[model samples]
Target: MSREIVAGVDGSPESLAAADWAAREARRRRLPLRLVHAWRWEPLEIPLEQDRPSQERTADDVLRKAESTIAERHPGLPLTAEVLQDTPVAALLSTEERAEMLVIGSRGYGAVAGFLLGSYGQQIIAGAHRPVVAVRSRDGAGGGDPEGGVVVVGQLGSADDGAPALGFAFETAAARGASVRAVRAWSLPPLYAYSPTSSALARADEAGGLVPYEEQALREALAPWRERFPEVRVTEHVEIGSAGQVLLGSSGDARLLVVGRRARRGVIGSRIGSVAHAALHLAPCPVVVVPHE
Candidate 1:
C-alpha cells in the first residue's frame, strides 16, 4: 500500500471539512494527499437527457473545487484528484487499498438519531482495509487540550484485544508530540464469587488501593508500547464502568480516539463492534477504528 492519505470529497460541507483535515494530516506526515469523488447515475435529473455526461461533469467539477480548496489552504502539498464511477462506499474502499489511512466525512452527531452514520458511512468504515477516520464538519481540527496533548484509546478484552489500538494511539502521539491516555474499564466481580483469599493469588495486590488486578493488567498491556515510544508521556486510567462511556469520558479535548474491531463482519448490518458503535455516534473528536484479527 502507498504511504499516502486518501479523503472522500463530493462538495458536501462535511466532505470538504474532511478534506481539510486530511490535507493538514498530510502536511503533518509529509505524505501526499489524494481527493476522490465518486459518481453514479440518478433517475430523475434534467429530463434524463444530460444524464451520464452531465453527471460526469458534475463529478469533475466537485473534484476540482475540492482540489482548489485543499491547495489554497495547504500550498505546495502534493495532491492528486480522481473521479470514480462506482458507488461511494465501493469507490472509497477500492481507493483505500492503496492508502495508508482513509479519512471520510460524518454528520457529527452525539445524541441524535441515524442520520449521522447512514448505511454508506457505516459500510465504508466497515469495509476499509486500513485505518478509517470519521471527521465531522465542525471543528475539523478534532480537538486540543491545554495542559497536554492527549490521544485516548480503549483497552478491552484479552491482552491482544487492544494491541492494535494502543499501537495506533502511541504512533499518533509520537507523531504529534502528544501524550497517550490508555483507559481500561472494569466492573465489580459478581457478589456470589469469593474474593481472592491471599496476596499470593494469581493477581496479587501491588499497592495503592486501585483495583490491584486491573491496575496490573493495565500496566502489563502498556509495557511494550511504553518501551517502544519512550519519549511519549503516558497516562494509565483504570475505571469501573462501560467501555464506551469510559473512553468518551477520558477523550475530552483529545486530538483522536482509537478503538479496535474484529476482522469478521456480522451476518447482517455493520460489524464495527460495540465500542466503535458508541464512538462513531458520540465522540466529540475524530475517531479512528482500527481493524485487527
Candidate 2:
C-alpha cells in the first residue's frame, strides 16, 4: 500500500493547523493525505422545536464542510476526506491497520474553554497502533523559514529500539538543513546506596559525579550517529529530570519530537511508552511517535 497520513479535523483553528502540517508532510514525502472528521449525535434525541434539518446537524455534513475548507486552503495536494459516525479516537484507531502516521489536533471545538488540549488527543496517542503525531497550535507550516530542524528521539533504554527514531530524526534534520539536538534523560539513585560513607554532608560531591555520568550516557547514545552522519550537526543534551518534561520543554523550537512506541505482540506492541504518551499531549510542538515495527 502507498504511504498514507490521516489527520483529524473538527472545524477548530488547531485542527486546521494540523491539516496544514499533515498536508506539508504528505507533499514532502509524495504520499496521499487522508483527512478524517469524526462526529456523533449525542443525546440521540432533540426537542421538536430545537431540531433542525438533519443534513445541517449530521456528521456527514460537518465532514463535507471540512473537506471544502481543505480544498480552499490547501490546494494541489493529494487528499481525501471521510466522515465517521463514531468517536474521534475510535475512528482514528479503526484506520490503524494501514496508516503510516495518524495526526490529530491538540484540542477541538468540544474542548472545554481555556484548555489547550482535550482528552481525546491524549487518549489516542497513548493507545494508537501506529505512530501518532499530536499537532499543537504553535506548529505552523511554512516554507523557507529559518526555524530549527531539531527532533528529539526518546530512547527507552535500548539502542536497537531507538534505531528507527534516530533514522527519522536524522533524515528530517538533513532535509531541513538544521542541526539535530539528540537528548537523553536519566535519574540516578542516592549516592548513599552505593557508598556507606557517602552522606548528605557529601551532597556537593554527589551532584558533581552525576554530571559526568549523564554526559557520558548521552555521548554513548550519539556515538553511532556521529560516525554515520558526520556531515549532520549534532548537539547532545543530558537531562536530569522527567523525560517527558525535558523533551516537552525543548520542543518549543524543535521541528519534530520523535519517540519510540512500545509493543508486546510483534516487533512492536499496541501501546506507546509512558514518556512518549505524556509528550504527545504536553509537547510544545508537533510530536511523532514511531512504532518499533
Candidate 3:
C-alpha cells in the first residue's frame, strides 16, 4: 500500500521520454518508480495463433528497454515494470487509484502525433483521481530545460482552494532546489463592462488599487506555504487576463507547471476547467493537474 510514482509506457519515444521524466521525479521524491505497459492483441477474428506471443513479446521488450534506460540514467533507483492486459486508459486509471501520481507522454504515433494532447492522454487526465503529469518527448518536444528550471503554478482561488497545488509546487521546487512562481490572474466583474460608472470604477481600480490587492491576496495564500517550505524561494505574479493564457505564457521556462482541478461529483460526469485544459494542450513543459477538494 506504499505510494509510488507510476508512468505509462508503450515503447514509443514519447512514452520513454515520460518514463525518463518519471524516473527523475521518483528520485527527487525518494520513492520507487513503476513503469506500466497496457497491451492487447488486435484482429480478434484472426485466432490466437502466435499473435498473442508476438504481442506479449512486444510488451516485454518495451518494458525491459525502459527499465534499462532508467537504470542507466538513474543508478540505484528502485524500479519495477508491469504489463497489464487492458486498454491504455483503463489500465492507467486503475494504476492511478494506488499511485501518488501518474505520468504519461504528451503524444504518440499515428493519429496522435501532431496533437499537443493525445486522446488517450486527455482521457486519463480528465478521469484520474490523483495528480497526472504529461511529459513531452525529449528529442525536441518534451522535457524541461537541461539547466535547473522554475516551478510555475496557477492560482485562482482562495488559500483553501489552492492549497494543494501551492503545496505541490513548493515541494517540487524544494526538491529540485528551484524557485516557485505562483501566478494569479483576475479581471473586472461582468457588470463593469456594461455600466459606465462601473467601468470608470474598474478603470480606477486597475490604475493603482486592484493590483496591490491581488498581489496581497496571492501573498496571503502563499504565506503559510512559504513558511512550511522556507528553503524554497517564492515569487508572486498577478496579471489581468485569461487564467489559461497567463499560465501558458509562464510555462515556457518552467520545469513543471502545476494547476488545480476542482473535484466534481455527479451523474453528469467530471470536467477539467478551461485553464487546466489549456495547460494540458499548450504548455511547453510538463503539466501536472492536481485535483483539489
Candidate 4:
C-alpha cells in the first residue's frame, strides 16, 4: 500500500482544521490524504436506541463531512476517508505506523475554546512510532502569520539527535519556498550564579568566549543540511534559555514548528520529552514532533 498523510477527524472544528492542514501538506508532498474517524459503541449501559447503528452513523457522518471539506479545499487531491471501528488513540497509533505523518487537532488549553489537548491526543503523541503534528484551530489564537511561511525547528544537544526534525523542517521550507530557522538552546554550567569565584570563572569563560563556541556548534550542526538543501535559506539561532520557550516564541511568525521526541523503549508510560510536551501544549502554531533515536 502507498504511504499517505493521515488526519484524524472527530467532527470538531479543530479536527476539520487538521484535515485542511493535512490536505495542504499532502499536496505539498505530492502524497495522498487519508481521513480517519474512529468510533466505538457502548454496550448494555446505553439504550438500544443509541447503540451500534447510531454510533456507526455518527462516525460515517464525520468522515463524510471531513471528506467534503477536503474536497472543497483540494479539488484534485487524491483522498480517502474511512471510519475505523476502534478507540481514537488505538486507531491513530495503528495508522501512524504506516503513515508518512499523522496530523491531529489540538483540543488543549489556549485561546481557542475547544483547543485543549485531550488525554487521547497526548497519548498518541507520546507513543506514535512516526511523526505526529498537532494543529490548532484556524483562529488567531495559535498566533502565526499565515503569510510568513517560515518553518522553525528546535535543536537540543547535538544535531545528530535532532537530524530528523531538522530534515523535516528543511523539506517543509523547501516545498513552501520558505526559510528555515534552526534554533539551538543552551545554558551555562551550574554554580555560575552561586559564588563570587564561580561568577568570575564564568566571566573569564565568557571572555575566552562560550558564545562563539555555541555559535560554532550550531553552525557545525547545520553545515551538512545547508549543503544538502542548497536552495533552502537557513538561519542558525543559538539562544540562552529553555528550548521550549524559544521555540514557542519563534512560533509566532512560523508556519510550522518542528521538534524532536527521543524514542524510548521498555518505558511504562508516555515517553514524550519535556520540550516536546511544552511545544505541544503552548506552541503558537502547528507543532510537529518527529520521533528520533
Model 2's TM-score against the true structure: 0.74
lDDT of 2 at 48: 54
Cα lDDT of model 4 by residue, 1-293, tens digit: 77899999999888888888888878878999999999876576644465568767878998998899789868999999998888999998888756999999876555333236788888898888889989877632222224336899988777698789988888888877889998888777675465656754465467576677677767877888899999988888878888888777667777788999988755586578889888877776788999898
Ranking by lDDT: 3, 1, 4, 2
Residue 82 lDDT in candidate 2: 87
Q: Write model 1 residue lDDT over 1-293, tens digit each, in one string.
A: 45889999978888888898888777777889999999877667455455678778888999999999889878999999999888999999887657878999888654333127667888888887688988887746332222337899888866688898889888888877889999999876555544576443334445544377777778888999999999999989999999888988888767788998887767785587788998888887778999887
Residues 123-226 of candidate 3: C-alpha lDDT, one tens digit per residue? 78878889988887852233343435699999886889898889889888988889999999988656536555674455546667667767877888999999
Error of 4 at 234 (Å): 0.7
**1-293: candidate 2 lDDT, tens digit per residue:** 67788888887767877777777777666678888888665554645544435744675666677677767766888789987768888988888876878888775222112125567875686567677777755564343123456666665455676777777777666655668877777677755566646552255365577667566656766778778877779887778788877776666667678877765554543455677766665665677877675
Give Cα distance to truth, residue 117, candidate 4, Å.
1.2
Error at 187, model 4, angstroms? 0.7
Off by over 4 Å in 2: 40-58, 108-115, 141-148, 190-231, 264-274, 291-293
Q: What's the lDDT for all of these models?
A: 0.81, 0.69, 0.81, 0.81
Candidate 3 structure, TM-score to reference: 0.86
Q: What is the lDDT of candidate 3?
A: 0.81
Indicate the worst ten consecutive residues by lDDT in candidate 2.
108-117
